[model samples]
Target: MTIQNSHNTLPLDPAQPERQARDEGQGPMPPQAPTPTQPLAQPTPQAQVVPQPIAYQPQPAAAPSNGVALTAMILGIVGAVAGFWAVVPITGYFSAAFGFPLAVAAVICGHIGRARSKRVGGVGRIQALVGFLLGYVSIAVMVIASAAWTVFLFIGSL
Candidate 1:
């Protein structure tokens, strides 16, 4: 087979029969006539795809992490426990020393946690408040114990 370009005279490969037919100004080849030996297969009509409107599904809001509140609560508990030990005489000094920092930390964490809870939602608000109260109570206990110890020491020394 040979193909002649309208612009120039050039022979095209027989392998590209579609290109040759197109160059010759002919459209795609028609379906072949089925032989008697091979029955003609009817073209099955395809189902037309109708796009349905997607239903709007609102996803549930994820819970925010309240680790700060949790930390505050834990620190408050531990600090309160240490402060309780401040009831003792000499040992109370060491207990107060150990617990004061913990109490302070608990108070700070509680305030931070409470603010965050208010800002983000009321998830850990209770815990934060509890921690704040516990920390103050612990500090009070330590202060009272230290004063008592100081007076007792001063009187004994005189």
Candidate 2:
């Protein structure tokens, strides 16, 4: 019927006298005797602990969009074109300067790309093969040009 001034208990409606008001840290107190002046004995209240929720985080993406074989293909094409020019009469030195290293890199990248593609079930087998072929052709051209230059020098010295 009235608010408990001392215990900070919840307010009660006079219509529901049977309902008991629970304290912040105390459990239900036994009902008081018919005499309103007497106090009832109360049991010790148990403290309930609520567990906190853990935070969720997401990881970064792993796979690349375009294939490595595509890169090998382009490098092989450029290197082969450069090395082909080195086989010419006057452009050997100039082309070799850039072509030799590029051709070697192309060959290495092509093989690595092919192996990686195979492992990942990639659809760049043909591209890798073409790139590997171009790299081999470039290296062969460079070798031939070098051998011919050496032979010409040997013959001219005589």
Candidate 3:
């Protein structure tokens, strides 16, 4: 018997799936070439569509409201207006005298509003200032009128 070389392996057959090499570490499988009988694919140029921008309309933003400043200003104005009767002589000093404390409360609220405005946004600084001014004017008017009335009574008694 003739000696055959063991290292000389027989060529692998395509019909045998198990006999094919495992393609160790070689990247991807190469694309198959088209046969003479099969026609190559052709890429056709079609239309290019351009995207249209959307029409988006947004509403305007509203200014934030400060409740403390508004309340202070309202109280100050009311006290200033109601203090008119308190400036009178006899009965004015009785019932309308309560406006003095309201004025004081307005001043306190105005100070609180100012502090809050500094700490957090949206509190009205102008409204707080106006409230403070109104409170001060109301208190001044009450003091001066009361003093004048007392002086008038003293003079009348003499």
User: Best TM-score goes to which candidate?
Assistant: 1
Estimated TM-score for each candidate: 0.61, 0.54, 0.55
Clashing pairs in 1: none
Q: What is the C-alpha RMSD of each candidate to the true structure, in Å?
A: 11.5, 15.5, 17.0
* lDDT per residue (tens digit) for residues 29-135 in model 1: 55455647777788899999999999999999888877788888999999999998998987899999999999999999999999999887798999999998899
Query: In model 2, which residue pairs have backbone atoms overlapping below 3 Å?
Result: none
For candidate 2, the per-residue lDDT at 66 reads: 31
Clash pairs (backbone) in predicted model 3: none
RMSD of 1: 11.5
Over the stretch 1-158, how does candidate 2's per-residue lDDT look in tens digits?
56666767554663334444343435555654545555666768988788989788687877643366777788789888888887777787578667877777777777888788777667677777777788889889988887787688789899
Candidate 1 Cα deviation (angstroms), residue 74: 0.6
Listed per model in order, the count of residue pairs whose N, CA or C atoms clash below 3 Å is 0, 0, 0
| Model 2 / residue 133 / CA error / Å | 1.3
Total backbone clashes of model 3? 0
The 0-to-1 C-alpha lDDT of every candidate, in the order given, reads 0.87, 0.73, 0.73
Tell me model 3's lDDT, rounded to 2 decimals: 0.73
